[model samples]
Target chain A: MLSDMQNNEFQTYGYTFKEVGLTPGEIARFLKVDPSEKEHPANVFIHEILNKLPDNKEITGGYRILPVDDLNVKEGRLACNNVELNPGRQVSTCLQKSEYIALFVCTAGDIFTGLTRRFNRRGDSLEAYITDAIGSLTVEKAMDGIQSQLEKAMKKRDLQITDRYSPGYCNWPVSEQKELFALLGETPVPVSLTGTCLMIPIKSISGVIGIGKEVRKSKYACAVCGDENCIYIKIIKK
Target chain B: MEDLLNKLHNCVEFGKTDINSPYPPDRKGQKGALEYTQELLEKGASPTNIMELALIPAMNKVGRKFSENKVFVPQMLLSAKAMNVSVHLLKPYFRTGELKRKGVFIIGTVFGDLHDIGKNLVAMMVEGAGWEVVDLGVDVKPEKFTEALRQHPGAVVGLSALLTTTMVNMKPVVDAIKAESPATKIIVGGAPLSSGYAFSIGADGYGKNPQENVLWLNAIGYAK
Candidate 1:
C-alpha cells in the first residue's frame, strides 16, 4: 500500500487486486446467491472471474482530505476549503459532525469493461452480465479497503469516520462530480467525469467520507432513501 | 409435442442453454431450449401455442422468482439467454407474419444517462412476453423517442434511467411524447425510479422490475 502523506493536496492510494480481496461471498451478497453452494453457477462464475483479476501492481485509488471550512446545518449545506456543496438534506445531516471531508475516487479500470464489451459484441450477454457485475463489485471492494485504511489512520488520531456517501445517492446531485474533482485538486483523478456527470470509464466510483470524533455512521441512508438503484442498498439488503 | 414443450419450459426456467452447456449441473448434458424448440416446430406445434404455453410462462416464472428473491440477475439473465435462443428459432415465423405480435414497445435509456443494463434486461423481458421491442439504445434524446413513436404508432414507450440525476430527465422525454401523441402510454422503469416519480412525470405506469413491465403492458390491453 502506498499513500500520500496527508496534506492540502490529494494523495494517491494504490493497491493490488489481492489487497482488495473481493471474495465470492461478498459479491454473492449483492448477487443474491449463496457462495457456499459450491456447484451454483453464479459461485462458479465468481471464482472464474476472481482468478482472472488483474495483478497487484495496479493503481486503484486516490483521495484528498479537505478541511470543512463552514457548515450550514439548517440548509443542509457545507463548504470545504475551496468548494460549496449541497449534497442534499439527508447527506448534509449525516455529514454535519465532520471536521474534515475525505473525497475519494477508485475504479476497477479498463480491463473489466473491455472484456464486457468483447463479450457483448459476441452476443454472449450472460458472460458480459457476470463480468460487469464483477467489475462493480471490484471497485466497491477496493474503495472499502481504502476506507478501512482511512479509518485506521483516523483512529490513530483518536478521530472517527462516517460511512461513505457518493453523488447521485441520498439526494446528492451527481453533477457535483465537477465540484468533487475541484476538491481533489490539480492532479487529475484517473477517472474522468462526463459533461453529464456520468463517469467515462463507467466502472469508476467517486464519493466522500466524514472524518471527525463524533461522526459515527449510524445506519445507511439507503434504509430511508428512495433510490433503489444504489448498490449500498443492495448490500444492506444482503 | 407436450413433452417437448415441458422440456423447453424446464430448459428456460432452469437456465439450460443446450446439450453442451453445463449451467444447472443437474441438467448438464441434456438437450436444452434450442433443441426442444426445433423439435417442437418439427412436430408441427403452433408457434403461438409454444410461446403462450412455454416461453412466456417460463420467463414469467423467472420474473416472479426475481421479484420474490428466489432468483437473481444471473438466473434471470440465464433464462433470458434460453428464451432469446428459442425465440430466435421463431423469428422467421414472426417476420413472415405467421406469428402476430402483441404490440410494439419502444424503449431507451433517457438522455444524459448512459447506463443500459437495466434497460436491456427490461427489453429482453418485454420481448420474451411476445411484444415486438424497438430498443433505441443508450443516451437517447427525447426526439429519438418521438421519432420512434411516429414510426411505430400505437406503440407503448419505456424510458429507463439508473441515476437519480438522470432519472429526472424522464420528465422531459415524457413531456415531449405526450405533446406529440396525447394518447400514447409511456411506462418507466429503473432502480432509481418509483411509481410516484413516474406519476409525477406523466408516465402511464412504473415497473418495479422487468416482469412488472410485462404485466403493465398486458394490463393495458397488449395481451398476447
Candidate 2:
C-alpha cells in the first residue's frame, strides 16, 4: 500500500543512528549480562565498543515487494510472480497468508567489522566478542527501523504483515541466500552474498516479510526450528 | 620444585597470566604463570616436568570446566593466555629437543567463509593443549588444506565454517583431503554444524566444542 511501491517496486532507505537508537539494556541482554553489573568486564568492554560506534555512520537497507501466486508446502516452494524460491517448510507455513513477499537486505556499515578484526588480531578476545555482539545488535536495530517504516505505510491501507524471516535462520538453509540474492535482480541492495552464502558486510542481515490484509505478525517460534546450534536459542532461553 | 610447579598449575588454571594480571581478583598483584614458570626454570626444574606437571593439567582442567559450562569463553581465553605465556618460556627446550609437543594441528576456515573467530578459538585451545598449531587463517581453499597436510604428514586437520552455506563447502574439502591423504584425520566444526553433518561430510571427527576436540586428540594417543 506504500505509494511508491507497486507489484515489484524496489525501495532503498538510509537510517541514522538516532533512528536505530540502540540502548544499553538491549546490548546487555544480547551479551547475557545484567545492566547493573556495569563493572563486569563484558559490560565494561561493551561500553567502550558502543562509544566507538559513531552515530555519523549511517546504516542502509533496501526492499522489494513481489506478489506471491503459489506455495508448495511439501517442498516449501514459494513462487512469487515468476521468481521461484524454496525457502523450506517452516517458512512456507508461516508465510501461508501472504499476498506479497518483501525481500530485504540491511547492513550496519563496515566499521564494526574492522574493529572486531583489529581486536581479534591483537588477541583481545573479550573486546572482539563484545564488538561483534554490538555489530549484530546494530544491524538488527537498523532492520527494525526499516520494518517499522514499512508497517506505518501499510497502516494507511489497513494491510497487515507477517514477521520477517531470513534464509539462514529457522529451517531455511543458508544456501537459499543465493536464490534470494538472485531475486533482488542486482537492484543495488548494498549487501552482497559470497559464493559460500555469507553476506559481505559481516554485520549485515537479509530476509523477507509477508504482506497482506489478512497476514499477521506472530511471536517467533523457536520450537519449530531444527538448528540446535543457533545462538538465538541461548538468547531466547536467557 | 614440585610445590613451585603446583603453584604454576594453579596460576594457569585460575587464569593468572603475570604479576600484573588483575583477573581472578583474589590473586591480584601476586606472581602468575609466567613468573612462576621463569622461577621454576631458574631453579633447574625440567621443562618437560613444567609441561607435564603444570601446563597440560591446567589446560585440561580449564577445558573440562568449559565443557561443563562452569566457565565461559572469556574465562577459557584467559586461561589459554596464561598457558601461552608459560609455554613461551619452554620454546627453547622444544627447539633443543628437551621437550616435545603432543603433535601438529593444521586448522583453517573453509574456502569462501571469511569468519575466523571460531577457528581462532579452536586453534588457541589446541595450542594450549600442547599441540604446535599451524593456523592457515580464513577463506582457505581445498588445495591449501591438502598442501599443508603434505608438509605436516601426520598432522590432524581441523575445518571450520560459521555459516550453513560455507558448511556445505566442507564436504568437498573433506573429500579432497581424503583423496590426497587417505590416512589423515579431518575434524570439522563451526556454529552451524552437528556431528551428523560432520559424519556425512566424511570428517573423522566433529568437535562440538574446543574441549571436545582437545579430548579427542588426547584420547587418540597423538602425544608421542
lDDT of 1 by residue, B29-81 (tens): 88999999999999999999889999999999998888887888888988989
| Candidate 2 chain A weakest lDDT stretch, 10 residues | A226-235
Instruction: Give the residue spans of candidate 1 off by over 4 A.
Output: A1-6, A37-39, A56-59, A219-228
Instruction: Encode model 1's per-residue lDDT on A112-205: one tens digit a residue.
Output: 7788877777767767787888788878888888898889988988889998888877778888888887777665446887777898778889
Consecutive 10-residue window with the lowest summed lDDT within model 2 chain B = B215-224
The best candidate in terms of lDDT: 1
Give the C-alpha miss distance for residue B188 in model 2, angstroms.
1.4
Q: Candidate 2: which stretches are off by over 4 Å?
A: A1-4, A16-19, A33-39, A223-228, B222-224
Clashes of each: 1, 0
DockQ of each: 0.58, 0.51
Judged by lDDT against the true structure, how good is candidate 1? 0.84
